[model samples]
Target: MQRIISFLCISIFLISCNKEKTDGFLINGNLDNVKNNSLVQLFRAEGRQTVIIDSTRINEKTFTLKGKIENPDMYFLTIEGIKGSLPLIVENETIDLTVYTDSIFASNIKGGKENNYFNDYQEFIKKIRTRSNHLTEEFKLAQQKQDTSKISSLRKEYEVMMEENDANDLNFMTKNNDAVLSGLILERALSTNKLEFTKIKEIYANFDEVVKNTRAGKVIAEYITANANTAIGSVAPNFSGPNPEGKTIALNDIKGKITIIDFWAAWCGPCRKENPNVVKVYEKYHSKGLEIIGVSLDGTPQQKDAKQAWKDAIEKDKLTWHHVSNLQYFNDPIAKQFNINSIPATYLIDAEGKIIAKNLRGAALENKIAELLN
Candidate 1:
C-alpha cells in the first residue's frame, strides 16, 4: 500500500510539472515582395539573443514558430528579407504580421494610443540616431586633432544634446506613456541619471494617471513602482545581523569610508562566480579608502549542511571583507529595502554616504573606481 501511494505521488508531481509548460505561437503573414526567403527572429522582451527560442527562415508568406516561453510578455518578431528589414511585436497566441509587399510595413502595428506611441517612437529613434551620429563625428574630430580642449568642449556639447533628448523623451511620455517605448525610455533615464529620481517618480505617476487601461500601462506602473521603491540613491536602509564571527553589526556604523555594499548568497552560482572579480577590485583599491560590506542572503541551517557555505566560500575565496547576514535569506530587511530581486547586487556609496552607482561589476566597476580614485 505504501509503495502504491509513493507511485501515485510521483505521477501527480509529473502531471503538475507538465501542466506548467506554456505554448508559443506561429506568425502567419502576407507581404507583397517578401519572396518566401525572409527570416524571422524571436527575441524575448527581456533576455539575450543567445537564449532565443528560435530564429528561422520563412518557408512561405506564412512562418510557423514553435517554443514555450516561461512567461507571457512582449516578444519582438523581426522579418529580415533580401530587400529590407521589418520588425514588430508579438504579444498573444494569434498575432497577425501582414505587411505590404511594395514597401516593408513602415510602421504596421495595432491598438489605440499604444499604436500612436509606436509611431512617435519611430520618430524618436531617428532623432536619437542622428544625434548619436553627430556626437560620434565630433568625438572623432577631437581625437584626430589631439585637442584636449576640443574633446572637453565636444563632450559637454554631447551631454547637453543627451539632456535635450531626455527632455524630449519625457515630453513624449506625457501624452503617450501607454507604450512599451516610453517605459523603456523611463527605465533608461532612471538607470543612467543620478539627479533625475524626482522626475522619474513624476513620469511614473503621470503614466499611472494617464494610461490606466492598456497592458503597457500596467507593466509600466509595476516596473516604475518597483524601481522607485528600492533604488541605490535613496538612503541605504539599515539591518542588524550577525557575521560569520558571531558578532552583530549594524549598517549605520559603517559611515565614514566609501562602501561597496554587496548582497549575495551561497546557493547563487552567479554570485560565487562573480566574487573573484570583486575580490581583485577590492584588493587593488581597499587601501586607497575603499571598503566592502557583504550581506549574505543564505537561508537557515540546512539539511545538506550548506548553512556554513558562506563561511567556507569566504575562506576558500580569501575574501577578507566584512560580511554579515540575518540568515533569513531574501526576507532580510536590507534585501527587501534595497529591492534586491536578484543576487550579486552591488552599490557604490561615496564617503558622503550617498549611493553613487549600482550594478557596477567586473570591468565597469574597475574602470569607475580608477576614474574616481586615480
Candidate 2:
C-alpha cells in the first residue's frame, strides 16, 4: 500500500496540469467536520507553470465558489480538514463538487462539452481499473504455473493493451473537442494524470505542427518549442557567470570538451549526497577532458553561512571541478533560462555544446561516461 501511494504521488507530480481558471467550481460539503482556520485552494496550469487562482472556506459544512476560467486544466478539491484531495478538471462550465473525508463526487452544474469530459473520464477510470485487474491476474497465473515463457508473453500483451488504452483516450478528446485550447488542455491533463510524461514529449515532438495549426496553436506551439529545445540532444543554452574565484567563465568558452552542468544547492541534501559519485567521475575522466560545472542556488554571497556550507562540502567531498554561483537561488539567471525548478538537476553536454544525456548518477552515471570517454 505504501509503494502504491508512493507511485501515485510520483504520477501526481509528473502529470499535475493545474491551469489557472477565471472562474472556479461550486463546492458542497459538511463544514462542521473540518477544523477551523483550514483553507481550500483552487489550482490551474499556465504554460509550464501551475497557478493557484482562488481559495475559500467552508462554513457549517457548505460553501460555494463561482467563477469562470479562461483555460481548461486540472483542479483539485482539497480539504485542510483531511489529508486527501479530489482531482477535478475545471472548464468553462459550472461544476458541483461534492467532497467527503476520503472520497469526492462531482456533477455538472452547467451542461455541455465539460459534462461530456467528466463522463468520459469516469469511463476511462473504469477501463483502467479493469485492465489493471486483468494484468494482475495474468501475472499471478504465470507465476503460479512457473511459466517463464508465458510471463514474457503476458507482459507483451499487457503493453499492447496499454497502448490501445492510450489511443482510445486520445480519440475521445480529439473527436468531440471543438475548442483548440480544449484539446491541448485535455492532452496535458491526461498525460499528467495518467503518468505519461514520455507520451507528452512524443506528442510535442510528433504533433507539434498539428497543435500549432489549431486555433490556440501559437500558445501550444511556443510551449512545445521551448520544451523540445531544452530536451536531451539539443544544444545546451550558453551562459556565463562568476566562478568561485570571482572570475568570468562562459559555457561557450569551454567548447571542444565534455561538460557536465550540475544545478544544485548546499541546502539540497540529495545534491550533497550525490557529490561523491561526481567526484569519482571527475577524477577518472578529468584527464580525458571531462569538465564538471557546479551552479549553486544558494542565497546571497553576503550570507556567509550558505557560501561556507558549499565550501565545506567541496572540501569534504574533494569535488575539485569548475564551481560557480550567482547566489540567486532559483532566481539565478541560468536556472531560469534552463527552466530548472528542482535541485540536483544535471545535463551532459558534448564537445560541440550539444546536450547528449541528462540526470545520470550512480552506476548509470559511471557507465555512461565510461562508454563515451573510453
lDDT of 1 by residue, 1-374 (tens): 13222212211100001112235544455554566767776665331123465677766566666664432334444578544344443333444455665655342443333444555555655565566677778788889989899899877876676666556767877766555455555644443453355776677776654344344455445545655644667655556678898998876776435778889888778988999999999898888878888998887445154458878877887888888887677666677667566788998877766677898889999898777766
Q: Which ten residues in a row have the lowest lDDT in candidate 1?
A: 10-19
Write one digit per residue (lDDT tens) for candidate 2, span 241-341.
88867798888876546889988887788998998898898889889989888888887435568667767767777878877888777767787667566
Pick the lDDT winner: 2
Candidate with top TM-score is: 2
| RMSD per model, one decimal | 14.4, 7.4
Q: How well does candidate 1 score on lDDT at residue 150? A: 88
